[model samples]
Target: MSNPLFKKINIFLKVNEQTIDSYFNANDPAPIYKRQLSQEFEEYIMNYAPSIKRYSTVTYKLNCVNESDKEYLDPLVHAIRRHFSLKKSIREAEFKKFKKRNWVLLTFSLIVVMFFQGVMPLIFNVEHRIHSAFSNALDVFSWVILWKPIEKLIFYWNPFLKEISIFDKLINAPIIIVGEKKEVAPMEQEYAA
Candidate 1:
């Protein structure tokens, strides 16, 4: 038996002038490190998204046919890191907003429920027939009003955190460049976590 944490997951990228353009938006005039990744390239990367695990040793392996092609390595890696880092930041903001919204909703619902149960009783005497009916109705209404936010708070948050985690992993994953003569370029200092 082997520890799953030791498993290696490699995402391979062929780096060169011709293929580099295909990785980014063709219409974008920005430099490679600033350009948005193309839809096809994003989709290709996402195909491996589900396989990533918290302890998985994920890496990006860049293969360059010529030594000249290796010049593009730093820019390409920077682009990838920038893309996923932005995604993680956006997801974190969204998660924060989600938590705040749900908390507000739950608080509002509790206040409304309390008013219905507390103040409404004073309007109708306890012995009145309509009192019981209104009380039961208020209980049902409170449950209905609170259901959505409670459900969201309990069950819906895992996906947001999951996406953020995935983006973080992608942003920090090690990148290795392999050249034609089987030479391994030392990891650039800027790319190191």
Candidate 2:
């Protein structure tokens, strides 16, 4: 029986002279470590993407039939790291942009609300019946104007942070190489790009 607390999610890849190229985009002229992953390969990995959670662990299980095939392991791991590292960086940038945009919108909405609540009141004498009616309308309008930005600030950021966390885990996940006859090679440490 396996320990329930130590859950592992394995993404299996067959590493060899023939299949290695299939993992990457053939059109990319860059080196192996910098090349973009193929769409099919990415889809294969994304099948396990949603299963990653706060307590779950991800591992790349590479199957190498020949001794020479083991040489491709480092480059493959490096490419995976680089790809997800780039993804994480891009997500961080988008998250920053999201925060900045929402703050700006909230600030602008507050300014508008202030103008309606403060400046508009002086335009009409407070004792007049029209002034009392307009005051109530403006109060409701202020809340309506401020609703979207406040809602976005409160709720919309969770998904971005969650995706960034997933990418971070993928970038630093461990790698395990397995050979024929059920023999396991030594695990490699995190590959930093």
Give the number of the best model, judged by TM-score. Answer: 2
lDDT of 2 by residue, 47-122 (tens): 8877877677988889999999988888889888888888889999999999999999999999999988999999
- Pairs with backbone N, CA or C atoms under 3 Å apart (clashes), candidate 1: none
TM-score of each: 0.87, 0.88
Tens digits of lDDT, candidate 1, 111-136: 99999988998999999999999989
- List ranges where model 1 is wrong by over 4 Å: 1-6, 181-193
Cα displacement (Å) at residue 82, model 2? 0.5
lDDT of 2 at 137: 98
Against the true structure, whose lDDT is highest?
A: 1
Query: After superposition, which runs of candidate 2 have C-alpha atoms over 4 Å from their true positions?
Result: 1-6, 182-193
| Candidate 2 local distance difference test against the native | 0.87
